[model samples]
Target chain A: MKCGLVAADGAVLHRETRPTPRVVVDARGGGRAVLEALLETVVELGQKAAADGHRVRAVGVVVPGIINAESGIVSAENLAWAGTPVLAELKAAIGDQHVILAHDVRAGGYAELRQGALIGTTNSLFLPLGTGIAAAMVVDGSLVSGDGYAGELGHTRFVNGEAAELCACGQWGCLETVASAAALARRYGVRSGRVVDGAREVLELLAQGDPDAEAVWKEALAALVDALVMYTTLVAPTRIAIGGGLVGAGETLLAPLREGVAARLTFQRKPEIVAAVLGEEAGCLGAALMAWDSITDESGEQTV
Target chain B: MKCGLVAADGAVLHRETRPTPRVVVDARGGGRAVLEALLETVVELGQKAAADGHRVRAVGVVVPGIINAESGIVSAENLAWAGTPVLAELKAAIGDQHVILAHDVRAGGYAELRQGALIGTTNSLFLPLGTGIAAAMVVDGSLVSGDGYAGELGHTRFVNGEAAELCACGQWGCLETVASAAALARRYGVRSGRVVDGAREVLELLAQGDPDAEAVWKEALAALVDALVMYTTLVAPTRIAIGGGLVGAGETLLAPLREGVAARLTFQRKPEIVAAVLGEEAGCLGAALMAWDSITDESGEQTV
Candidate 1:
């Protein structure tokens, strides 16, 4: 877990990374271990912040899952958390601090919107091509929560016909199945009949003129272009910030998308495609920014 | 044009159909004729309402084109209106009344949301399969305008590969190219080598067991299913209200959509597919409702 103590003025005073416990699905109260780890991390971070002469007024916790806003429960496949009382657990761990629970991608997008590449955009998209693909859609200056059901752009189908593959989400031919970081590595292995380190090795192999790596990269690009075109046509975003692991490839990943979406569009407004600025710390920084915003909000004060 | 005056309590106080003046594109001040006709209609309607002991408060004007919120200009190709100052013109013609300009399809969706098929939905879609396809997206209990560029669902690409037909929107393989009412009639004529009257005739031929009608109908259904499934996966609406002339087919259209959307959905929430209740007069009613709401707003009062 990457976390930090951020001042109200958006300065990071302290930072730390902690190992997340492996979620055991078969163990009794399997999700409890994950929750406990999160609670410990937050509590320890709060203590460290205080030790450094800081007063914590609010806390923001973001996770990758469907966050039920009203019930304050979460359900994540990887975390083995099925409607776990996460908000209640957080309140129990840190008494009386203003808490905000949000989706990781949306929070990251919020940080980008407030301070990073996507600043000043009213309608924009923040897409992270990580191990799993998800989107944070900003519509008319607000992040679309859809009650935590929105921004599953990665799960939408893009690959068509026989080339379509079944996704981990039980859907056929989802964008995540072909375009995500994990998919790039997995598809490279299946295409080349050899295991590579990850998307990093795949990128290196492409740079070295490997045919298998080229094919897999091309496939991911095609699906991603299709997804972007569809999103542009439907939602009409003026800017899109591409982030996560695959964005590490830099111009190699962005150029094709810009060109392909441009070629496909006719009446729709073209979006400025840019790389995300914050990298891995985006989500953590966003959480802190949100917590600070909450503190200001609780005091019923406005900030410039 | 079907027009109506609706009471604040959702009652139809008055209704009528008026002949629209044919736009003269080559004449001096070409689009002005149509604008004049609309002005005359609104003025006459207001006079009639006052004659019947009703007080005029606000005016709502909706059209089938982009409504530029900032400039209050409209540019509809079919209407031969190119950046016409519509809102300003309306205010000049009907002085001192609060004027609202909206998209016609969006107005229909608003009516459906208020008192029709989507009465209680917070997140829903009002899709009309007419001569062209467009969507009125109700996300988080509010209609999403996307600055008038949004809700062109018809224009989104659906047909894949070599068989993709070019849509009038300049995009190839759009949902409207195959799934719209005009598409059904056009495709039917092309298939049977006999020009049919319209989609109504195509429906009749289907009932009579014509192979050509069955083939075209199946093709339309397939593309529509693709569009709906894609929308459901991306937006997560709780219900979908299908409107326009095509909904006249009733069960023949809705049952298949419900079944197909249900079958295609995996992790996404399944939206209830139902026929739109308000029919052709929905836009007019919605305009009045919005006008009434605006009056409430101007008076600083709340309405149920």
Candidate 2:
């Protein structure tokens, strides 16, 4: 987990990384252990801030899941959380303080909208090609929450016919099956009949002009292009910020996407494809900003 | 055209239809004639309202193209309008209390949301498969305008590779190429080599167990299913209200779509697919409602 003390002026005073505790028994569910680690991180950070003569105003926590902002319940498949009352626990741990619960990708998008590549755009998309894929949609100057269920662009089908593969979400031909970082590593290994470390090794192979890497890269590019074109046709975003692990390839990934989407768009307005600026620290920074905005005070009094 | 004066309580106080004047010269744009006819209609309607001792507070016009809400410019290919100053022209004709310009399909969706199938649902879709296909998206209890460019689901590519055909929007394999009412008639004609009158004849042929009609219908159903599933995965709408001429076939059209979408969706929320209730008058009613909403009052003065 990436945690940080971000000031009002968007300055990072201090930052740290911590391990997420794994659930010992799958039968009992892994959510509690994860929640406990989160709580510990927040408490320790507050203590550190006080010692350093800083008064913490609010707490913002970003999780990779659907956030029921009203109920403060979160459900994430990777984290093994099912309707976990994370907001209630956070409130209990730090009484009477404003706590903001948000989707991790959306928080990252907020950071980008405020201070990164997507700044000044009302209609845009923030997509991260990580181990999995999801999107943060900005429509008419507001991030579309879709009642905590919108912006699953990766899950939309791109691959067709027999070439299609099943996704973790139990859907076939999802964009994540081809364009994501994990898919890159998996496809490269399958095509070459040899296992590599991860997408990093695949990127290195691509740099060396490996045929198998090129084939998988081309396939990923086609699917990404299809996804972007479809998204542009339906939502009409003015810009799209590409982030997450796969963006480490920089121009290698973005260049082809820009070209393919450009060639495919007919009557639609062209969206500027760019790399995300905040990188890995975006979610943490966005969380701090949201928490601060949720309540207007440094007095530790709850307004909402 | 179906024109109406709707009360704030959603009552149709006065309604009428008029012949649409066609443009004369091939060199001259048809937009000028269309705009003149529209201006005449609004002016005459206001005069009629005053003679009836009713006050005209707002004027709402719904058109079949991109309505630039900020600039009040309209650009519709079918209407031969490109960046036409429709709102300014309308305000000049009728001294505006409030003048609203909106897309016809979206206005129909607004009427549905206000008084029809989508009344209670916040997250929903109003899709009409007429001569063309378009969608009106309801997300977070508000209609998504996407700055007049969103909800072009018909233009999104569904058919890929060799099976793709060119769309009027200059794209290939758009859902509208196969799933729209006009497409159904066209495909049936192409498949059987017999020119059918319209989608109505195709539906009749389908009821009579024509093989070619069945094939085209199945193709349309397949594409529509893909489009709906894609929409459900991305936007997470709770209900989908299907409108337009194709809905006339009733259960024969709706049941297949519901089944196909149900079978294809994996982890996504299943939207209830139902036929729209407002019929052809929806656009006119929606325009009136929008005009009423744009301002605060009706002072009971019967001013023309």
DockQ for all candidate structures vs. native: 0.73, 0.81
- Please write out the lDDT profile of model 2 over residues A1-304, one tens digit for every residue: 9998877767788899999877554655577888889998888898888878788877889998778888999888778888789999999988876689998988889989988989999999999899989998888888878777888899999998899999988989899999989999999999999999989899999999999999999999999999999999898999999999989999999999999999999878899999999899888888887776666654532111
TM-score of chain A of 1: 0.96
Query: How big is the positional error of residue A160 in model 1, measured in Å on the Cα after superposition?
Result: 1.8
lDDT at position A45, candidate 2: 90
Residue-level lDDT tens digits of model 1 in B1-304: 6666666677887788888778776764668877888888888878887878777667778888888866789988777798899889988988887778888999899999999999999889999989999999888888888888788889888888898998887889999999899999999999899999999999999989999999999999988998888888778899999999999999999999999888888777788999999988788877777767766545422111
What CA RMSD would candidate 2 show? 2.2
Off by over 4 Å in 2: A23-25, A297-304, B23-26, B298-304
As a whole number from 0 to 100, the lDDT of residue B111 in candidate 1 is 92
Candidate 2, residues B1-304, lDDT tens digits: the string is 6787777777888899987667553636588988999999989988888788787877789998888888999888877788899999998988745778899999999999999989999889999999999999988878888889999999999898888889999999999999999999999998899999999999999999999999999999999999999999889999999999999999999999999999988767789999999999889888987777776765433222
**Candidate 2, A200: how far from true, in Å?**
1.9
- Model 1 complex DockQ against the native: 0.73
- Could you tell me how far off, in angstroms, the CA of residue A120 lies in candidate 1 after the best superposition? 1.3
Chain A TM-score values, per prediction: 0.96, 0.96
Candidate 1 stretches with Cα past 4 Å from truth are A295-304, B24-30, B297-304
